[model samples]
Target chain A: MRLAALLMLMMAAAATPAAAHAFLERAVPPVGSELATPPGQIVLTFTEGVEPLFSTIEVRDAHGSVPTGKPRLPPDNARQLVIDLPSLPGGEYTVIWHATSVDTHRTEGSYRFTVH
Target chain B: MSDIEIAAAVLRSVHVAALASLFGTLLFMAVALPVGSGTAQVRRSMRRLVLISGLAGLIAGLAWLTVQSAAIAGADSVAMALHVVPTVALRTQFGHWMLLRLFLLVVALFLMRRPGVAIQIALAGVALAVQPLLGHAGAIGGAAGAQLIASEALHLLAAGAWLGGLLPLFLAVGCLSHEMAAATCRGFTPIGLASVLLLAGTAVMQIATLMGGLPGLFGTGYGHVALLKLGLFVVLLSLAVLNRLVLTDRLAATASTRPHMRVSIAAEMVLGALVVVAAAFLASRTPGTHEQPVWPFAWRLDLGVFSDTASWAEPTIALGATAIGLAIAVAGVIWHRIRWPALGMFAAIEIVAIPHLDVLFVAAYPTSFFTSPTEFAATAIAHGARLFAADCAVCHGVEARGDGPAARSLPLPPADLTANHFRAHNDGELYWFISHGFTAPDGETAMAGFSGVLSSEAIWHLIDYLRAHNAGIAMRRTGSWPQPLPMPQFDAQCSGGRIIDLDDLRGRAALIVAVSGDEQVEPRSFDNIGAAVVVVARGIAATPTGATCIASEPQVWTALAIVLGVSLDALAGTQVLVDQDGWMRAAWRPGDAEDWTDPNTLAARLRDIQSHPIAVNMTGAQVHHH
Candidate 1:
């Protein structure tokens, strides 16, 4: 199934179907695109509110699980979800996100990028 | 309803009820006071009916005042000084109107015993006219304010006629002799017509105020309530017509069948009471955000003839319907003394006219209540549940303790909260407390202090959720704090903004921020609040800039700098200049020794000095100096 999924992705279009409840929208980097340099911060946008507690975001490089800072809300606005990434080496990186709002809405998603 | 909302509603209800009782007594006195020479029989009967309604109304006014004590506070009020005003009355809400109304009420009551209907009617009208300006809506300015005052007047008069008219109609049906019944029914025409016109005027004003234009009626909660009121009003009007056309004819045609009119009158009275109850509920629920401004963007409710969008826009010839209404008001005024179809016609007209109002008078609220549904709902529910538990739960319970652990400990066992508390009473009775709250002068029941403990939002939510909770009704409480107001952020202006040192101006005898000896004031000089550099914007004229040193002594500059939190040496470089306005301008760091127009500019210069607002953000965001 993993091989099938990876194989299918090579031929599939870049898109995700809409569903009920809050979900992630655009991420900072084009999800599947290669990048020249790793971003200093990873920001996630959600259609509905997210709980800062359960919701977590992580950036893992080739060396694995680098220490990270707790997600910080932008001083200008709280509703928009955000997370700062740890310093990473030049390698493939994956950003995973998860969280739930008090209203019981839940969401999770992932994207990967490469450093120069 | 939070306490403030309930207090607001309470103050409104108390004023309304007080106004009603005051007006009702006057009307009763007006109709009941005249003695005619021909018949001692008719004179005596009129006097009895007048006395009953007038005094009973005064009692109701007392009831209104009793509920009102919690809303208005402070002693030595005009109400306190008035010998006749009830002990419970808060006289200040009425200002000058109360004295005039009291005099009118007294004269009418006195005249009813003596007989003189014409004198009473005119006086009653005057009393009604004066009470319109003393409501919540009128407190605001502009079109919205005018509509509120107008709507409240109509509302009060309509209520007086509708609710106040009930007592007379009831007596005419059940207890009055055949002559009295006929006379009473006949007397109703003028009162009804006068009442209906004012009601119609008020109805229009209130609709205009709340729903804005008709299109606004659906999107806003105010609009929803408007629709509900319009629907109920139509029903009341139709029944009113039935009383006039169908029932009045039967009763007048034969003396033996007059008993039947009593049943019909009872039904109508019941309906009137039901409407009153609805009015009370209507009063309690918040009026929608005024939709008047949004009319061009949407369509109003479909008039059957005009609703092309809904295809229900069909016009009925309401001319005949309106004729029935106007004939009574005109006939009543033309001859208030005639005992005929005029009174019946007035009731017919009024009942019929209930639905056409535009701006509905409602309490105004800050915009935050409209934008945040979660916070609003939560506040209302929390207030309601807490109030219910305090007031109703003495019988209902904490956790609905009808027979819980704390059941045996109190003066009254608590009522069950979920017992569908909302349905136990209509909006009128619930409004009596849910709007005003229950209070006892002496420390009596634990439930007495609802106004102090819970908010009006909570009371309303409790009411909305509680209405006879015997079965499947669901309830919810919202817990949203409103989103904090967005703080302003100035865009970075300087292309190469950098920290500068203003240390050069320090320790000197006030470095003069000198422009040349010519005068032309720059607009940006308006932003400076610093005392160190006083820009003499050419003092009086721009003829001679003479922008020489108004440089105060160094002691003055340091003191002024200390006062303003400005930097002395902060303006060392980075395009520092003295503008034509003669004020020094420079870019500086945030944590500076001195204050500048923009904090970001000042903090950039400070580099090391710290303050709460800037420091909290800097440490949190982890911004550092290069």
Candidate 2:
């Protein structure tokens, strides 16, 4: 009886859903997008909750870094980081983000978008 | 590994070994010593083992904390580690768990001075249980995570009971009389059996969860260490079987076999210690699934070959022959008369089967199992298309049809990138071919290597473009997409004042309408239809009302254009039907179809898509092989 119970428990543990590692699930101005006009902000939603203090979102163009506010969590959402942007001239831009999940696992990625 | 990593691994191994030995000794004394068989000498020996192991565990546990602190603090010496040890012990989760473990050990040791077996067992068990909470098991959250943690704890306890019990059993064998020794051995058999069963079950669960599969098992450092542990365990299991089945019975019959039994048990103790060391190294390394697997073999098996009737005969004969050979080998072990004949028959079968088995394998490279670092996104595809025009188009051509101006001058013509055979090669294989260059069978340089010319990320971008280009070509020819393409994800605000993501629309049908610059779309034209209507409008001053969701994100138009194999301007009137599985099933171009705009026509299309769900080739979507 004990062996059978143990077997069932093992099966249950094996069948459970996979745990998260905080990959970027979605992004504003979406990855590899080409835009005709500039957006007001950049929003990144990850697979797991991230620590705002350790996370950063940097936007840059051909000349230098584009001015943006510090990365902050949106209202009632710990998994998202929002950055407010200023009015910018038309050019190609790259968005680089570094995120440290609440569990302390860190991941970083960069993608490009054009403002024509 | 660095010196600090090596130090941490050694300290962890020592702590685990000491704890297992301590727990095993107490457990044996409580349950498996056999009634009235605990002689003064036997009892004294057991007590001494417990004290030594318990003290060793305490010291090792403390030392482990110091080493871990040093690694985490980036410290260079013992003095530097000592300075930060207190901070680590007080401030971190690892520190808290270690403190709890140390307290349990102290209590278990104190209780051992008395005769309270249940309390001692409970304390030691809890101490061991603390380990899983500090390792990979604790990283997960939720009810399933709790269950996984429990399984890990049980696995550790079972190891302690079996491997740790060996030393105490050895002491019992040496100090007790022949009958008592045999009885003690009998008592341990069931405990060992139960531990082995639990160990096997938990090990399988861990492998399935963490190993990623066969590619991981053969490719990563963690999997290599796990394989080493498995090898040691198999040897230990064989020794255990020999002891229980053959040696124990001999010891029961006569006094002469006691020395032999002692030697066997001592060997098992050493093997178990080695297994613990391998496990420690495994724990320190990243899980196989997280690492990029560099496939080590020259050839890889592809069972998909069996789908072809012409290719079935050789592999079938090889498999059948192998089964027969194994059966004969097992029979040879059971019967002495057939031993030589069985060996010869097996050898003959192997010689025939080995060559035929080649039909099941294909040539492989070091990067054959490597997953692309870049996702199959439009930006990547766009970037790759530019790179291909600059570097690859000279020979492969702008259309990748091997008809470039330079193609006629080359020794061999470049291969067509959009052929059906192109789908057979995985993203990794294509990445390798593109970066390292392809060589024809006749020794001609079919393509030049581009490693120095392009970055690794750039190569991945190029591969993404190739896939999208091929997909685009196939889609144009088929009217419907040849394979399912994931809808490019975007964030939007819905009409009901709710924020929604394109990914959130999965498990239901959605009609994505791309409107460019003041193109009047009847917001409720496709209303009352089963599918959700998502308007991806650009250059519009106001958000459209009555749509399920609306996004003015300009990039959404560009991304959708790439999928439809058209320009940004050409994307304005194109409407795509995405099925419940999140795959783009059918598309309606501007001038091609006005019928899909009707409510009845759109609803009928939704039903058709719902009934015939596309079989998405997940590998094309994302490479999952670590």
TM-score of each: 0.37, 0.81
The model with the greatest DockQ is 2
The C-alpha stretches of model 2 lying farther than 4 A from their native spots are: A1-116, B1-4, B62-103, B113-116, B142-151, B253-260, B309-314, B337-354, B489-502, B524-532, B536-559, B566-569, B591-594, B607-626
True contacts kept of 1: 0.00
lDDT (Cα, tens digit) per residue for candidate 2, span B1-626: 77888888899999999999888888998888976735778988899999999899999999999988777666798899899899777865567889999999998888776877888888888888777776656655556557768888989999999999999999999989987898889999988999999998888777656665555666888778888888999999999999999998999999899999999999999999999999888877767766667788787666667778888887888778977997998898889999999988988987887677676668888778777755465456667888888999889888888888899977777989877677778877887898889777898887888888899889988887777677667767776656556776566767644557655776678888887775886665444555688887878854546756877666566667666777778778778888877778889986785586676788888878878876643432363221
What TM-score results for chain B in every one of the models? 0.41, 0.86
- Candidate 1 CAPRI assessment class: incorrect
Pairs in clash, predicted candidate 2: none
Q: Can you give the lDDT of residue B10 in candidate 1?
A: 42
lDDT of every model, 2 decimals: 0.44, 0.78
At residue B559, candidate 1 shows an lDDT of 23
Candidate 2 recovers a fraction of native contacts equal to: 0.06
Against the true structure, whose lDDT is highest?
Answer: 2
DockQ of each: 0.01, 0.14
Looking at model 2 chain A, report the run of 10 residues with the lowest lDDT sum: A1-10
Error of 2 at B378 (Å): 1.8
